[model samples]
Target: MFFRALLLLLILLCSNCENQKGETSPILQGLLALDYLILSDPDRSSVYFSTTRSASVEIAYEDGAEPNTGNFAVAPTTSVWSVTESNLINAFADRGYTVNVTVPTDLSSMSEFPDQGRSTWTINQLLALVPKYKAEDSNFQSAKFFVVFVKGSLAENSGVIAVTVSGAFGIGAPTVFVFKEIINHFQDNLSPDKVRKAEQMTVTHELGHALGLVNTGIPLSSDHQDTAHGNHCTNTSCGMYWALGDDRVDSFSPGTNPLIFGSECITDIRDYTP
Candidate 1:
């Protein structure tokens, strides 16, 4: 009987030790904090964090269903942003994390953007840009999703992710406002044929920022090329590379679609996810 009692005690102690170890280990919790930044700029928004650690992500659109209120309507062809968001969600979902998208009406106001700095999307507009997920899935409700704006400048400086669209260059962020001189040059001097392609590539590039594949501005040596895309290395010929300009038609690789990140980029994301 004494031996059996001791055995029970040993089992309980082992279980308790495991629980304690789990409580103290940083791997799961550490991953969560990293994921918070990877998903979006939690610092800029007012989302709450939990004390307990878990492998789930939640996304809320700032103003998903509002009407467009800008000077001009968004072109029909520009609706690819929603497609891009869908692709992003699918890509993340394939990796075993849960993501959720919400549209909190109370958080839907234009004042979210500061007045003093460069004009950008109001919180309301940003919310509107976020795509709506119609398909019913419980997992999506628990995963990390992002908000987007349909009619505002593409410039977003949310904590670590900053996106700027160069409208004049016709290549980077499509919604960015450029100098009148640049706009005139593109309209008159540059080939009008390239505008559409440039706009698409620009959105993909900006999305790269959203995914945390940033340019470190360091020159690439031969040794670094395999790992870093020369200087722009991350994986999958990501749009984050600075060498891709608006003027060149071949700069946009259909095989390496801007929406899909390279393999190395995926590893970085997985590492960043909590």
Candidate 2:
């Protein structure tokens, strides 16, 4: 409604300006003042509300685990994806964003995850099963996002554990797809806490993409974006670190190097006024 009013006002002013030629009438001045007020109004523009964002998660689960061990509906917080969500929530909060995460109670089957035993699935292929996060909002200024958890791993040939993709040529619609098999691999290799940290770091790193870190969309504080690393930070300690997660796990035990978000990446998200 506000947008409509703004558009109508603009159209009327444009028509009046056209009809009146160059005559600076009182009515034209009034219209100009109204336009200035509209642009400066907090309720009309996004200047006041850019600080908050809403985010949600959808988990794609396997109906039946081949080993009958893994389940998505169990204590959701115990899920590796939950760890990831928690880290994201904290990161955004630190950046002064209000993050809301909702996990659907019902778990969908592996069919929602992949074609068969092990297959590669695209973002559209997966998002078809569930809708992205949306708001029943009168105010359209809020930032909204959806992060998806695919219950199975990608094809063995595909060396990646997860990928972050944006909608329509990476312009806006932000979503993250995490392969459960990757978390499963970490769970087997690391201790319980370390596994949790690994999951948290994995999701946090991907969430960085959605937040436009490493010069993807968010401007860098420095010329430190590792283009060679593909939208990853050059500093290894940063959450946007580009190295393969599995490779880093073997190398950096909690005793030596901890999983944490880099200050550079955090600053990018926090200070990104756009």
Candidate 3:
């Protein structure tokens, strides 16, 4: 009986050690860098990071001039693309991973060129564009989230990140929508650098939602919690905070390296990622 007892204790200890190792595996912390492509300028944007290669990105632009259409503009210089890509990569890198970006030829012309006067496109119109590109490649099936630019009002109800989570796993991948009206509001009120940083913050914030982060107050009992499982940021400075303003880029600042979700959120993502 004593020998059997010793054997059982040894088995339990070995099991515990294996569990701890699984929790700390490097794969859990490894970076998955994203590549960008305008689709239209595929050649120029094809470059990628040496470590952990990236998948292609396709951006679609909405015609801003049509009646009721929104105003979205892309910078004339290639530097704009580079700067945006660099900003996103840096945001991820700050969290301990190296990121690389690539711009595709198809996305070159996918600038925000919305007309100043019209407001015809609705959220549904913008969402319809997602499947077009998502179906183009199989890699997108694994994307943590996707970002799209749209022309619309930045009024309190103007922008949002739509999330879809399954059962108890919490949030699945998220799709980020940037409104032209909000971007313009920042441009007029803040410095260029601030505007750019704000844009990056918004996109990153939406991606956080896609990755299982949730607001502090949202009831876990709700079905939404089953999928949207990240922590809520009470710190207004943190990106996870839900209340953000259109006029100030700093309104979105929790710093680039936003905090991870509570234990629940982490568990959900761990189950989903692998």
Candidate 4:
């Protein structure tokens, strides 16, 4: 609908501007506008309500930050990847898009800091991994989202369990870094289920940032953005809340009945155009 109508209008305008050719013509201008409309927000363009393009999710972990436990032999079972992958697949499937999630692989030698406690990856260090991944894996460079499970914290925000870097800042697709050690420390490593659930909540919350939630990149249907915390919903029960707690994870299990995004966030996602 709306897109089709816009396309038809552009085509009709092109016909009228046939006599005036070259870059100054209305046709070129209209086409350029269309291109910007589609490409301006790359993540949202591919992830939200996109019928033509499918989405790919790449998972990688540092050498010491492998996302697996001995409790489950099903590879990523009882791991962060298991929960996040299934959540993304189900979310995209609901919107009529196929999502391809790669298995967790090792990202070696990219650690700039010495140890886990003081290891903080700067933006430049994170950007450096982009080319290395693109060189090794063919599908990595083109993925809509890149998730790296690491053992340290973000250079900018050390207290956060995870952080999302926007592709709009020239990183290509949005990249998410889950601080495995921090999550483990925060959860006190009590049990596999508790740690995994905490990790799942963190990853899902960060992925919401990648998808342009809370009026960041994606347009909002209503005024639900939390003015206090940037790019987070005001609803405390929502997964996109500023800070996630054990209660959130305990209440909502992945793949069963996860009300991750509240009504406002869902409205923004479904009502978005280009």
Please report the candidate that would top TM-score against the real structure: 4
lDDT of each: 0.34, 0.53, 0.40, 0.63
Which candidate model has the greater TM-score, 1 or 4? 4
Q: lDDT by residue for model 2 over 1-274, one digit each (tens)?
A: 3443665687687677678576666665666665565554332113322634555543444333211123232233344344445545655565455656543323442223333443566556655544523322212344444445555554432446567765433433555666655665743556545554555566667766765667766667877788886788888767778765555654534332333667777676667664
Q: Which candidate tops lDDT?
A: 4
lDDT of 1 by residue, 232-261 (tens): 453335544544444343444333343545
lDDT of 4 by residue, 1-274 (tens): 3454676677677757774654456565667566565455444433345542445556666667865423222233344455565555545554544445543422332233223333888877776666665323212223456677777777787888888875433225667877888888774444666676677678778887877777766777888889889889998887788987767756765445544777777777777755
Identify the superior model by TM-score, candidate 1 or candidate 2.
2
Q: Which structure is stronger by lDDT: 3 or 4?
A: 4
Residue-wise C-alpha lDDT for candidate 3, range 1-274, written one tens digit per residue: 2333454565556555668564533322221111112222111111111122343333544554111121112333333234334433443343234444443333443444444343534545555656654434323221323556656653335443222222111212234556645665644556655555555555545555543355321223322342232455443454555545554344323233223233443333333321
Count backbone clashes in candidate 2.
1
**Model 4 residue 16 CA deviation in Å:** 24
Candidate 4: Cα lDDT at 43: 48
Each prediction's RMSD to truth: 14.3, 9.2, 14.1, 6.7
lDDT (Cα, 0-100) at 137 in candidate 1: 20
